[model samples]
Target: MYIATYIIDIAALIYLMGLLYSNAALNTSRKKPFLIAIILTIVIILSEAGTVLTNNGSLNLRGINIVCNVLGFILTPMIPIAITLIFSRMILTTHKLLLISTFINIVATALSPIFGFIFYVDANNQYIRGDYFFVFIIVYIINLLILVIITLEVGKTNNYPIIGKLVGLSIFTIIGTSIQIVYPFTYSSWHCVTLSLLLYFF
Candidate 1:
């Protein structure tokens, strides 16, 4: 599981780098979205690394894991906004929404330590599930809805196939994210891997 997760993380990082390069090369309106995606990708990679290190019983790098988790919690919602912007090509609506969502997500994550009992450290010094896990799940669902709505609106106005692809990808991502959130003990790496592939292809 760890190796699989690491492989996926590396692939995601590579895809993000490619996106950054493509955005730099093309004078497209999706630049900001692509950049945001890159940032999220970096955060995800760091979080995954943190998980792996901690899981392996390494205490020296546990602080890095905490940092990654905090960052991941903050940046998770911005992903859908970035996706909507990248494929939809509408700057005003998508960009503004992304900014707002990012701010909200940051605030939520910052407050999680205080109010979110969804996560806690176990006696073994490992990160354990918290009681307020549902809150994060709710936030993810809202983010997914926003992505879908934005995609639909863009598709209606432009009638682009990319919009359709984005919608499909967003649905897959939402489902994958939901599965993991709802069933914390189950295996959902495939969903994540598939979503990452969809993002790369789309």
Candidate 2:
């Protein structure tokens, strides 16, 4: 399971890099969010790798899991913000809804340390899933709603290509969010990898 997860993570990292390059080539102002997404992806990949290495006894990297915890709590939520930015450029209109969504993303990320409890390792280094896991589900739903709104807004205004990209992104967000929700049970990393591919292709 770890090997599969790691392979998917590596693919996701490559996809994020590609997205960065593509956005740069198009001179899109959305590059900042994409760059941020890239950072988030890197952090996730490293965190997973660090966990696996430490577990396998290949490297005694202390505090690595803590880093993973921090990144997952803080950085993962920025994905919606990144999508908002990307769609903003393609749609060419700054709606109040987008602003609100961005604010929500920021707030959620900031409050992650306090509110995040989906899956955390306790002081004894034992994995303890939080009781407030449903909170993350609600958050994911909101994020998905935002993506849907963005897709609709983009489609209502933009040309076919941009609308198509938005549609694709929306699908990716849905799939990725679903994967994340089931991650604990299934332990699959394909969610992030597929999300990165969507980001790259879109």
Candidate whose lDDT is highest = 1
Per-residue lDDT of 21-119 in model 2, one digit per residue for the tens? 865465556566566666666666666565555532423333455456555644555566556665565323554454454345445544444554555
Quote the lDDT for 68 in model 1. Answer: 62
Q: What residue runs in model 1 are displaced by over 4 Å at the alpha carbon?
A: 19-26, 55-62, 88-105, 114-116, 185-202
lDDT tens readout by residue for model 1, 1-202: 7557656766766665676666546455666666667667556656755665674376665565556667766666667667666656554543555455456557766765556554554435477655766556666667678778877886778777676666677777778776866675453634473355446444
The alpha-carbon deviation from the true structure for residue 27 of candidate 1, after best TM-score superposition, in angstroms, is 3.2
Clashing pairs in 2: none
Q: How accurate is candidate 1 locally (lDDT)?
A: 0.62
Q: In angstroms, how far off is 136's CA in candidate 1?
A: 1.2
Q: Please report, in order, the local distance difference test score of every candidate based on alpha carbons.
A: 0.62, 0.57
Worst 10 residues of 1 by lDDT: 185-194
lDDT against true structure, model 2: 0.57
